[model samples]
Target: ADGAAYERALERHAGLAKPPGSLGRLEDLGARLAAIAGRCPPPIPSSPAVVVAAADHGVHAQGVSDWPQEVTAAMVETVAAGGAAVNAIARTVGARVEVVDVGTLRLGPVPGGVHDERVRSGTRDLAVEPAMTIEECRAAIGAGARVAAELIDGGADLLVTGEVGIGNTTASAALIAAFTGAEPAEVTGKGANLDHERTPHKVEIVRTALARHAADTSVEARGSLGTLASLGGLEHAALVGVMLAGAAARIPVIVDGVITGAAALAAVALCPDVAGYLIAGHTSAEPGGRSLPDRLGEPALLDLRLRLGEGTGALLAVPLVQAAARVLTDMVTLADVTKTA
Candidate 1:
């Protein structure tokens, strides 16, 4: 991000017709948009896009979620057909939706309209072994970066992170715990409404995975990649790639719920500057969702108690993000009003 542009935006906001700081977070968001665009008056993002990275988790076998792994692929097909909540939200916000099969298990033919970038069929159970080989994890990240680059080349000015994976919350919780050093019990929460009876079991599963991968995740190891390979879902790795790519291009990246939040943690581990490019779309109801942003030092823009992934929460925030930039570009300065008077 351009620090000079950010400072200029803050000065411009103070000079706007409205009282200083009256716009609240919108003012801050506008400055951030300027910082991202390297100008005091950034262009409002008109071509926003959301990349929904779909994948499956071997941890489903651990009974962490009530939803079957098949739901991951089924939801991918639904999103491709424009029948899912994400599609509707994206449409409402005038943002395009792109679904990528980063590691979704192929029960049969892959659906049309979904990008075929599968690094593997699905990840192995993290509790018993590494979720993916280091090579596979890197491949997934590359796939995500490629997709983000393609969309940017296609004129997408803003990117939103989304994902569809049934057992992914288990992986997300594990990733959050690993990066934030938060206990599994503190980060883990009901995913897809996992029954209260199973919540304890889910927490235990995260604990077990973290314990098994302690050496790889330790600070002395400096093993962010290894940590992700051990505990992250394929979609998580891909989302990390998307964030890194967006940051590299100086574009804003709106992060969705806990799953994408976990990916953001990994992305920050890889490149701390990625944090400056991230905008938390909402405060997810999930425990990790709330904690993840706090760890990144980026407060969420909204709190609708949303936990359904697919970038729905972040898509809903697209309008707010666009409005923020417009404030800086279109709003009149206090001097204008005084001159008119």
Candidate 2:
């Protein structure tokens, strides 16, 4: 972020007809956009696109989520067909939704428009073994970077992170605990209407995975990639790559729910600079999502108690993001409003 550009934006904000800080976070959001675009009045973000990265998690076998592993592939198909919540929200916001199959098990026929970049059919159960090989994890990250590049190259001015994978919240909780030093019980949440009776079991599963990768889980250990490879799902790794690419491109990437927040944890771990490029679209109902904004130094733009992981929450916040820049560019200045005495 450039300090000069930010100061210039603040100056412009003061010059606006409204009182200083009248718009609150909106004023701050505009200034940040100016810093991001390297100008006092940043260009309004247009042509937003949400990339839905889909995969199947081996943790599904651990009885963590009530939804079966097959639902991962089925929902990927729904996203590809533009039938999912992300699709409708993207449509409402005039953003395109791109579904990518990073890795899914038992996928019969992939619908058109969904890119096929499967790292593996599905990750191995993290409780018993590492979810993915180091190479596989790297490849998945590379795939996300490629997807971000393609979308930005295709004229997408902003990127939104979305993920679809059954049992992914288990992986997310484990990743959050690993990165934030939060207890598994504190970060874990009941996913997919998981019965209260089994929530503690899910927490234990995350604890087990974190314990298995204890050496690599510490932030000071400088083992972010190691931690991801050991416990992350393909979609999570890809989201990290996407975030890195967005930062490299200087495009804002709005993060979705707990699943996306987990990816963000890994991304910020790998490259702390990526934090400057991220936007917390909402505070997810999940405990992990609730804690992520503070870690990223950005407050959530909305709090819809959203728990869906298909980028739905992020997509809903697109208009607000666009509004921030629009206010800077379109609002009247005090000089314009006041006539000469």
Candidate 3:
């Protein structure tokens, strides 16, 4: 792919565009992706779709969240009701949000427009057994990817990955430990505004969960994605599917927070080349989220210290990406840049 040459060409192309650097990083991003796609100018993003995968975690019974286990179902309703944080942000960017019940329990008629993509009622108790069966993990991942395929087919030019399962951070912490060699405490964070002091103890608890799950002999053969399925919340699994689907389809995906970052890690582990299609939307205020972009070798597009995980951060990032895409397609050449310069 002439990786080095493509990068160089992108820089030259960006400089040749009108206004020199008025558009900032967006201009750089557009040019870079254009070269990667072997296009002088790339398509602009008008219809971006953000998929929110929600589920309840078995580990929540262990007291990992400040919010109740029931909040999973409640928040799913909020998203469907169009009153959640993500809904507001998606509205701002005019990106559609779809909620998928990847593996939640206590399910009934899911809210209208919510996809009943459940692979299981819920995962097994990770403290006592593997969280999910290998088949269930694969099914959940497939569900997410399939949802992404539908959205992309619906004329979406970009995809943003988000999730809504509580306690998933515990799984993310464990995955981060395995992938980044960071201790659980190093990667764990205070989810949903728990006491700042309790965050450290929360990390220790996840460390314990990882240790408890280590007895599962099938995990190693299961791959990182499988390992996450063994401990990850349903939304995490769906995000992994979304990441893989978006990468395979070559749609740029904006990652929201540490949870999404963890999913990206697992997705890349499943397909090492998937990282090429990812954009770290913002550094999450989640305990170990700040470390994610560096883990992926990319800088975040925003840093307002966001911690909400329902794709809010990623949806907020759409305007910037759109601006970037616009730069490639609409910006003029240096010859027409400006006489003021």
Candidate 4:
């Protein structure tokens, strides 16, 4: 992203026919698009792609979510078949949905149409032990980076983060708590509609994980890899990779919900510059969703109280992102207005 282009965009927005700042955040978004494109009028993203990284969590054994772990692989298959919510939403925005079995637990061949980049069958239970070894965490991150590179090489101008994994939110909460120093109760939420009775247990699970991995979460600890390996799911690690790759390529990476938000924090921890390329697609209904964006220092593009992950919220925000760029390219300048007058 070019600082000069961003300043140029701000000047261009002021010279547009509309009153100064009338477009509000849309104007800000347009300027950001310009910076990412390194031009005053950024090209409207024509090939937005959502990479839905699917995995399972051994934390499901702790009964943190209402949905069973098998639902993770099942949802991956549904995503591959184009029957999931993300696929329908992607169609509306003319975006492509790519499902990656980054750590899904399946004994057979990978689902058709899904990319095979499994770091492991699934993550170990975080409440009892580290979710992934450092090597496993790095491998998942590499898988995510590879996927992002392939999509970009294939002409995806914008990248959206998505994930599917039962009990993953527990891991998300743990990661958020680890990175942000937020308490378990503050970051934890009922995942997959888990009953109120179980929500408390979910919070406790996050607390236990954080307590067990206190050394890894310390500010003076080696780096984010330890914290992530201790509390993040494989999909979470993979999404971190995607964000880093997109940032390295100087493209926008739209993040979805709380789960991806945790990954974004991990990514920023690994590479602070990665924060510059992130766009929060939406803030979900979850409590952590509200704080995640604040931690990222990026306000979400939408707030529909949506909690469903699957990249649906981010997909819905794609058209809005395109519109932001279109505003710069399509709207008439005040000079044009004067000429017509």
Candidate 5:
């Protein structure tokens, strides 16, 4: 990304026919697009693609979420068949949807639309063991990077991160609490809008995971990768890979809700510059979702109390991102207005 291009975009915004700052954050968003694309008026992001990475968490056995782990595979099938909310939203937004089986525990026969690169059946029980070995974590990250590169090379101008795993929110909360030092109670939320009756148990699950991985919490000692390997879900690790690869490719990556937020924390921890490459699509109702923007220094574009994680929130914000870039390129300049006058 070109720092000079960003400055030039700000100048161009001031010269637009509309009153200065009329577009509010849209103007800033346009400038960021310019910086990322290295153009005064960045190309309107087209060929948008959303990757829904599916996996299972061994911690589901802890009774944190009422949703059975089998639902993860079922939802992956739903996504492949275009029956899910994300598929409908992606269709409406003219974005392509691809399901990636990174570490699903019991996926059935995969559809042609699904990408199969499973690192393992699913992650080990974080409550009892490390979610994955460091080697397994590296494999999942590598798989995510490869997927991102393939998508970009296949003409995807914009990318959105998504996920599907029945107990992922529990894993997401645990990862957030571990990295951010937020209490488990502070980060855990009503995942899948499950009954609040189980919230206490959920918090305790996260608390247990944190205690088990205590040595990995020291940033100087264990580092972000260690924290991620110790606490993150396979989907979360893969999302971090997608984010890092997107930044490397200089393509903007829109982050979804809490699951994606946990991934972004790990990604930024790995490479701080990746923060500049991210755009928060929406803040999930979950606590981590709300605090995520504060952690990344990038405010979300929307907040409609969305907690569905299959990239639905992020896909909804795609048109807004496109509009920002379009306005920069299509709107007339003050010089033109003065001439017409």
Candidate 6:
């Protein structure tokens, strides 16, 4: 059913006015997104929601990230104050930003518009222990799903998943490896500009954590919250739930960089069909991020050497998607292009 819907969607757009294939990949994005919604002129999500999940990670103590743990909360504050890149980009695209605090250890009042669903103080250090307790992980997933469902039910036609947490990318890469069965080195990256001196060390730390938990992860199934709790961040777990909800709601989700990608990978593992709702935003410059999902054949939309995990890349591609949707919706049929006798 999904494949057929996507096929006719592409066919309809390609048959629209203007030269065939003139609109390039955009026509494709629109057609696929529309098929996901199973509607012509699928809702453009006039007020698309960018759900930014913020949490702290004990892994930051492992020297995995160049920035301090405080940066996570500080940046969340900046995002709420409209000073972050996602804030600027979402504004340009007319999308609303909603920040969620899944497990910021020192959480206080978030901005009025942000959601506070703190499941725990923060995740445990993966280097010395699992990032989250199985129960905490479950709650985070439920929180994320609930957020996405609420946004969709409130008429958000599209959802862009984003995240913030200084050391969360380290958590994301670890999840990608354990879930995707890829090597830790293959999924780890130079997060937040880890100096050349520290990049390798950061990667090694992830490696050690993986080895210590090797038997546990191998024994776990990536298809449930337990798998996530064993090797993922609170934010990632929540994002995975959000993706699952978005898929069920027939909303297209623009996945951010490595962190968001990690969440999407877990979603795919949990519910393979949820991938239909995801649009690969861009290729992350994070070390092996580009190849993280080599098993999935679709290529990313952009590659401007971005390693940021703030969903900035997804926001950057929002216009392309909107433009594509416009093409499908506004284009006249080829038959209509001819004058009547």
Output the number of the TM-score-best candidate.
1
Q: Output the worst ten-in-a-row residue range by lDDT, candidate 1.
A: 214-223
lDDT, ranked from best to worst: 1, 4, 5, 2, 6, 3
User: For candidate 4, lDDT tens digit of each residue in 224-306?
Assistant: 88889989999999999899889888789999999999999999888887877888999988888966579756679899988
Model 5 Cα lDDT, one tens digit per residue, 148-189: 999999998889999999888888998888778888999898
Where does candidate 3 stray beyond 4 Å? 1-5, 8-23, 35-38, 219-222, 337-341
Which should have the higher TM-score, number 1 or number 2?
1
lDDT winner, 1 or 2: 1
lDDT of each: 0.91, 0.87, 0.78, 0.89, 0.87, 0.79
TM-scores of all predicted structures: 0.97, 0.96, 0.92, 0.96, 0.96, 0.92
- Candidate 3 per-residue lDDT, tens place, 45-154, comes to 78999999988778777777787777888898899999999999999999999999886666467778899998877677665567777778888888999999999899
Q: After superposition, how far is residue 144 of candidate 6 from its true place, in Å?
A: 1.0
Please list the residue runs of candidate 4 whose C-alpha ends up more than 4 Å from where it truly belongs after superposition: 215-221
**Model 4: lDDT of residue 142:** 96
1-341: candidate 1 lDDT, tens digit per residue: 88899999999999999888999999889999999989889889999999999999999999888777788899999999999999999999999999999988886767888899999999999998899888899999999999999999999999999999998989999999999999888888887864677889999999999888875554533488888888999999999999999998889999999999999999998888888899999988898997657965767999999989899999999999999999888889999999999
Measured on C-alpha atoms, candidate 2 has an lDDT of: 0.87
Give candidate 4's total backbone clashes.
0
* Residue 289 local lDDT, model 3: 88
